[model samples]
Target: MRVTQMLIPTLREVPAEADTISHQLLLRSGMVRKVAAGIYTLLPLGNRVVKKIENIVREEMDRAGGVELQLPIVQPAELWRQSGRWDVYGPEMYRLQDRHGRDFCLGPTHEEIITSLFSQEVNSYRQLPLLLYQIHNKYRDERRPRFGLLRGREFIMKDLYSFDKDEESLEISYRKMYDAYNRIFSRCSLDFRAVEADSGAIGGDVSHEFMVIADTGEDAINFCSECDYAANMEKTPCHIHEKELVEEEGPLELVATPEARTVQDVASDLQVNTEQVLKSLFYNVDGKLVVVLVRGDRLVNETKVINYLGANRLDTADSEEMLNNFGIPMGFAGPVGLREKTAVTILGDLEVKCLFNAVAGANKTGYHYINVNPQRDYQVDHYGDFRVAEEGDPCPCCGAPLQVQRGIEVGHIFKLGTKYSEAMGATILDEHGKEIPVIMGCYGIGVTRTMAAAVEQSNDENGIIWPAAISPFDVLIMAVNQRDELQAEFALNLYQKLKRAGIDVLYDDRQERPGVKFKDADLIGYPVRIVIGKKAISEGLVELKWRATGELIFKEKDKIIAYLQENLTAMKSSKR
Candidate 1:
């Protein structure tokens, strides 16, 4: 493609609204244009890159025996209702009325549609273990869609679903999909890991997310550098250091703390470690107040607390609710000496129960208890892990040291055993003519998000350095002075030669200065750049520069094409 004929509007100034490097470079390089808050129009350059990624994904999916199919973006509300997600999905689903006044939704996912389709067609267990996939547009009503394509209301996605007759077959299908995901990301030149993840509302026993390490990512991952164990912070297990107790008997006494509200302040006044402090928080779980206790040094993991309570939903009690329930302010609430008359369920952390004498809130302002020990002063109904895992903590798997790394989730695979199939009544007949629900697995890759994440993970201060496999153009050919007829003729000849050799070439034939062309070339970051300038033309040679290594070499004009082809082939072979 020639630059003059294409819409490559390179910008000199960055847009104010773009906070991330990918977002700024994509817009400034004329790759995409924003149509709405989270919706964007991909220009020619962006579309080409996305198409290349799609092709890579398709190849890997096909290698794993996945058959591709196209599904409707707009699905009937009845399908969701049948899956029992119409009410459960809440506001994230985009629902509207059709012309006939029937309810419909733009699909955020296709579990319901796929399950319903399979139930109607497949009947026997012989037809089980089928994998179906599609690359299409998906929509979700994100309340806050930031970071460009990373979080969008409408974007392209590749989703696949597997159907099996039993749990054993489902495991096999899940492993196939997981291996396919690894191959897909590896081929895309992404530095990623498949970390254990919470299934969330999807309702699954096991799931893993493919994360690419980046600073701008939203999810926090706790991984062990010594072993192959990693998990999302929400689901990561906390390992506490057990402290030996000092045998001493002191009566629990309430002393005047004098305006010490926070745990640190109270611990400081009492001359004790923060671990010797008990922090109490009131939560409203199903309209009942529940007190959650943990050590002052640790932070609460709300999901674990909710799971321990066996509740579907929970929220921190408001100040007014706390005052009305316990007649104490928010900061001064405590679980000491509270009788069973109060409709509050007490949950204490293992660390809190193991403490000898801990300082706790006195239930009165500006006062706290210094010698209060659990079971001696107050009692809790249960004890479990409710603290977030911190850095330098012990690894839950092999007892190795832990490390924290930030990563962008590019793909996820889940073993969704009958979560949707059973709920939607999708059952099939076994060989013995027995009816059983189909076990299912879900796999997804954020197509556009992977593109943005690649740019995020592989870039320099100049711009994005896209990998050769997924670059919009494998080679960039630029004539330093297009105005000069000799330079223009040389560039055109080289462009045709490269194209004839089956190379994807972007010919910069625009009448621009050498500095502007070079800057733009580096900013767009094609894997290899061949420059036809006056000095090189005089020597019957051209300068070749590798974008990733910033290596420059002068090669004969006839040998340039061979050099690029050989280099690309070697890089790909090394990856395998």
Candidate 2:
């Protein structure tokens, strides 16, 4: 490719709307352009990088015994209705009506279509343990699409669905995909971790998300300090509280605590330790009021609260509703008088019931109760794990402290059990000649997001540092002072030689300043740069630079081709 003929509109200034480093660099390098709030058009350079990632995914998926196939992006609403996800997916699904008024949706996933296909064709155990995959466009109506391709409403994705006759067979397919994911990201040179994750709307028995570690990531991940336990912050345990139950404590006393509405305020006003203050929160669980008790320093995990309440949604009781509808003071509601409401239930965290002499709200406007004991003052309907996992909290597996890191999720694999198969009546005969629902597993890689996340994980202040395996081009032939006859001759010779040697080379033949050419070179982040300057003509020495390390090495013009061939091969296959 030559700069004079290509659409390499490298920009000197970053766009105002580009938020993350990847977004800014992508635009500045003339790789992608914004089409809408969450939509983008991949330019020549961007499409090359995307194709490289796609090929890697295809190679790995095929190596794992997956047969590549194309599924429709437009699916019938009846299929989703049969799978019980038509309404459950909510507004995120891009639903529409065709000319005949038949309902359809642009699929964010292909589980329903895949299940329907299986129901029609795969009916016997002989066709069991099948893995099929495809790389295609997926659509989702994101409410707020920011961060470039990271959360785009329309993007490319690779989805692989597995069907097996039973749970045991499903495990074999799941493990194959899991190992393939490890190889795919490893080849991309990503610093990522596979952590336990909630299935969310996908609905599965177990799932794992592969996340690339980055400071600008949106997901919080908890990792064990001494073991292999890693989980998404939404569900990692704050660990089981093991404080012994105090048999006796100071007597209960009501104290004046005017305007102390928050746990910190109460702790400060009462001159007590934060751990010694018992805080109660009012939540509207399935339209019923429930007061949850925890230590002042602890935070509640809403997912745990929702699971405990067995409800689809869990929301904090409206502050005004606590006072008007329930006659409970905003910050002064306590479990001691909480049961009198009859309709409100009291739930306690494991640590709440073990407090010795804790200070608690008094259910009055201007006062709080001090030296209250849960064993004597309040009745807890249940005690369970309900607090957010915190830094330095003990690990659930090995008892070591945990650490939190920000991460961008790029891939997810789920052990889906029979969620979709049973719902859609996708059944196959068992070995014993009995018809049973097929067990399934879903595996996905965000093709576009993975490309952006690679930038997030591997870039410098200058611009994107694409890994060798996924770079737009393997070599950049930079002609310094292209007007100079000697420089142009040397650059053109080297560029032709590289192309003849079957290398993806980009030639900078445009009439531009050396500084402008160098800036664009770094912005594009080609792995190897060959500089043909006056030195190449005068001393027969070509300047060789590695984009990743910025290492400069002088090589004779005659050996430039061989040197690049050796180094480029190693770089593409290198792990780091």
Candidate 3:
């Protein structure tokens, strides 16, 4: 492709709305443009990158026994209702009504549609272990979409669903997809980890998220320092670490705290370590008021709480709600008299059980209880792991200190069991002629988000450093002076030769300065750059530079093609 004839609208200045590095570079490089707040128009270059990623995913999926089939982008609301998720899917679903007043929605996922289809089509165990997949657009009305394609309201995705006869078959299918995801991301040159993750609304007991390692990522992952254990912070298990109670079990006594409200404030006023205080937090879980207790130094992992309670929604109880509904002061709420004030359920973190002679709220303003003991001053309905896992926390697998890092989730695979099949009645008759629900697995890769994550993980200050396998073009040939006949002729000839050699090459033949072309070359970030300049005419050599390593070399024009063929293949084979 010739730059002068192509629609490459490179921008010099970064846009105001582009906050993340990937978002800024994508917009500035003219690969994508904003269509709306969380929607974008993929320009020619951007589309090429997305298509290349899709091809990789498609090839891997096919190799894993997946059959490609397109499902409807718009689905009937009745399908979701049949799966009992119509209302449970919440506001993220793009719900709409037809002119005839029937409900429908743009699909955020196709689990309901696919399971329903399977129920109608397949009838026997012989047809089990089926894997169907598609690469298409998905819509979700994100409440606060940001980070460009990473959290877009509308984006491209490749989703594959597996239907199997039993849990064993489902396990095999799940492992196949898990291995395929690893190959797909590695082919894209992503530095990623398959961390154990919470399934969330996907309704699965086992799941793993392929996270691209990046400092600007939204999710925090805790990985074991001694072993292979790694998980999303929300899913990382906190093991019980028993601590000896230094103080004897003293009689509980009320102490005047004055205006201390926060845990830190209470600890400071009382002259005790934050760990010596019991932090009481009230949450409105599925409309039922619940109080959770943890060590003051620990933070509540809301995901754990939600999963434990099997609640659809959870939010922190506001001050007004605490005072008006529960008759408890916001900052002075405690478990000592919480049941008397309101018959709310109380949950305590496992670590809270080890605390003896701890300080706690007095259930009255400007007062706190000293030498408070669990099961003595109050009772807990349940005790579990409710605190967030921290960096130095012991690993659940090896007991080594955990290390924390940020990462962007690019793919996810789930062993869905019979969650959807049973709900939708997707069953097959066994050898005994008895019908049973099919086991299922779900796998997904965000095509467009993968492109953005590549930029996020691989870019430098100049612009995006796309992985070689998915770069818009493999090589860029630029003439230092297009007006100079020697430079222009050599550049064009080399471009043609590379193209004929089956190399994706972009030729810059525009009437632009060397500096402008060089800047654009770096910004667009082609894997290999070949420059025809005075060296081409004087020494019969062309200037070659690698975008990734910035290695410069002078090669004879005759040998450039063979060198690129060998090196690009090696580049594609190796992960970044």
Candidate 4:
């Protein structure tokens, strides 16, 4: 690719709206352009990088015996309805009506469509195990799309589904997909980990998300550094504390906590640790107000609460709703002589249930109850660990200390079981000719997200240091002064040689200043750069620089190709 003929619109200044380093460099390098809030158009350079990532994914998927197929982007709403996801998916799904008034949707995912497809043709156990995949566009109505491609309303994705006859076969397929995902991310030069994750709306029994460590990620991962235990914050278990309960001699007493409302305020005024105080939060669970109690020091895991309540949806109660439902104010509401007449279900944490003399709300302004204990002071219906695991917490698996890290989710494989197939009526006949629901496993990779993540994990201050496996161009041939006929001729000659050697080359033949060209070269982050300058031309040599290490070496013109060949081979070998 020649810079003179290509639209390499390198910018001298970063865009004001660009937040992350990847977004800034991507915009400055002319690789992508933002069209709307989160939508972007990948230019030639960006497209090449994305294609390279996709090719890696495709090869790994193929190696894992995955048969690729293109599923429809716009699927009929009936498929979603059949799978019981039409109402469950909620606002994230982009729904629409055709001219004839038939309901349809731009698929946020394709579990229903794929299950429906398999149900029609795969009727026998003979075709028991099938792994089908597709690389296509996906749409989601993101309420607030930000951070460029990191979180987008529309993006490209590679979604694969596996169908099996039973649980054993499904596990086999799931393992294969999991290994393939590891290879895919490994090939892309991503530092990632497979952590346990909640299935979310994509109903499944077990799931694992491959996350790339990045500071800009939105998801928080709680991982045990000493043991192999990691989980998404939503599903992370709060480790049980072994604190001995202190038995109180007196009964529950209502005290004037005057002007103390928040847990911190009440705890501080009472001269107690946050853990000594009980925090009560109100949430709308299945159209009814529910008061949840937990240790003040712990944060609520809403996902766990929703799963525990067997509710399809849950959200925190707003102040107005809280005022309307509970007569007490927001921060002062707690379980203490509260009317059991209201259909409000009370839920407490394991620690709260074991408390002997815990403080709680008096349900009146500027007042609270002291020396209150559960089972004696108030009755609670349910108790569980509805709090998110925090740092220094013990691991549920092996009792190791837990650590927290932010990671970008690149891929996920889920043992969906009969969640979709059963709902969609995708069944196959067994050996006995009895019909059984097809077990399913879902595998997915964010094609564009992987590209951005590569940039996120690999880049320095200069720009994106793309891994050689997915670089837009393997070698960048930069002519310091294109107007100099000799430099231009030397650059063109070397470019052809590299191309003939089956190497990808991007020839910078533009009449730009050396400084501008150098900045752009680094910003684009090609693995290797060969500079044809005055000194190099005069000395019958070319300056070779490694983008990753910023190491520079002088090579004879005749040896340029050999050096690059050897360096590329070493880089490729290192990746393997």
Order of candidates by lDDT, top first?
3, 2, 1, 4
The Cα local distance difference test for each model comes to 0.87, 0.89, 0.93, 0.86
Tens-place lDDT digits, model 4, residues 365-446: 7887777777777887898988888888888888888888999998888988888888888999999999999999999999
**Candidate 2 residue spans exceeding 4 A from truth:** 245-247, 286-288
Q: How accurate locally is residue 76 in candidate 2, as Cα lDDT from 0 to 100?
A: 94
Cα distance off (Å), candidate 3, residue 467: 1.3
List the candidate 1 regions with Cα displacement exceeding 4 Å.
240-244, 324-326, 337-342, 573-576
Q: What is the TM-score of each candidate against the true structure?
A: 0.95, 0.95, 0.98, 0.97
**Which is the winner by lDDT between candidate 3 and candidate 4?**
3
Greater-TM-score candidate between 1 and 4: 4
| Each candidate structure's count of clashing pairs | 0, 0, 0, 0
Candidate 3 ranges beyond 4 A from true positions: 243-246
Write one digit per residue (lDDT tens) for candidate 1, span 144-228. 9998988989999999999999888988898998898888888888888889998877878799999988988888898997998
Q: How do the candidates rank by TM-score, highest first?
A: 3, 4, 1, 2
Maximum-lDDT candidate:
3
Q: Which 10 consecutive residues of model 1 have the lowest summed lDDT?
A: 567-576
The TM-score leader among the candidates is 3
Q: What tens-digit string does per-residue lDDT give for candidate 3 at 14-115?
A: 899989999999999989999998899999999999989999999999999999999999999999999999998999999999999999999999999999
**What is candidate 2's local distance difference test score?**
0.89
